[model samples]
Structure formats: C-alpha cells, structure tokens
Target: MSDPWLPSLITETPQAGFELAIKLSRMGVKMTQPSDEIRKKLRVIYEDDADSLIAASQVIAINYQTVAAANNCWR
Candidate 1:
C-alpha cells in the first residue's frame, strides 16, 4: 500500500486552524494506540466521562495554540 499523506498544518483561518488541531489530536491518539478495537472499547468508557472529555479538549486546545503560532495566527 502507498504511504499516507499528511496535509500541511497551515490553514487560511482560525476556524480552519482549530479544525486542524482537532485532527492532530485524533491522529496522535491513533498513532499512539494503533488499535481500533482497544480504542473502541475505551470509547464507551470515556464517551460519558466529563473529566476525560475535558482533558481531551485541553489537548486539542494546546494543539490549536501550536498551530496558530505556526501559522502566525493567519496574519
């Protein structure tokens, strides 16, 4: 199979940048775990856990901050 292609993190707007941050967060989880079955099993537990969800949002926000800085806040 061909290698996966990762698009540039650079975005044209803050909204888009935030979306990219979310993608980055998800990709990190996938790469770290690399097991769909395990992730699915854990999803059921985290789906309803407020603290877990909040922690996830925090990670995404951090990623957004990094992306924004890299993009110079879209100038």
Candidate 2:
C-alpha cells in the first residue's frame, strides 16, 4: 500500500505545503518521520512567514468553495 503522507508531501505546491504544515501543527499532529532535517525544514516553513501561509490557505479555501458552488454541492 502507498504511504498516505507521500502524496500530500510530494503533490503539495509550496503554498499548499506551508498551509498544510500549519494546519497539522495546530491539530497537534507531530511529525513521525525519522529525518530530523526534513522535519526542521517543515517547521521553518510553517513557523516562518506564517501570515503568508495563512493567506495561501485562504486562497485554497476560496478556490474549493468556488468549485463546490459550481458543482451545486454548496447546499
């Protein structure tokens, strides 16, 4: 079976990765990877420039909302 986190990590755009790491951090989800270097990078991206990260999240939310509305799934 494929590792579930691999898709999210590999497919994420830079903005998406920043937003996702922030969300995961807020949810108290700790990193499980063995590589401390990768974890440190993720932490830096999520903690640094947090406002920009949040803005990216807002953009993603808006895009999803638009798509759902277009599909009549908003109701």
Top-TM-score structure, candidate number: 1
**After TM-score superposition, what is the CA distance of residue 68 in candidate 1 from its true location, in Å?**
0.2
lDDT of 2 by residue, 1-75 (tens): 334643333322445544555554443323456566776777777776878688757766665444444445423
The C-alpha stretches of model 1 lying farther than 4 A from their native spots are 1-4
The C-alpha RMSD of each candidate to the native structure, in angstroms, is 1.9, 9.8
The C-alpha TM-scores of every prediction are 0.90, 0.35
- Tell me the lDDT of model 1 at 74: 82
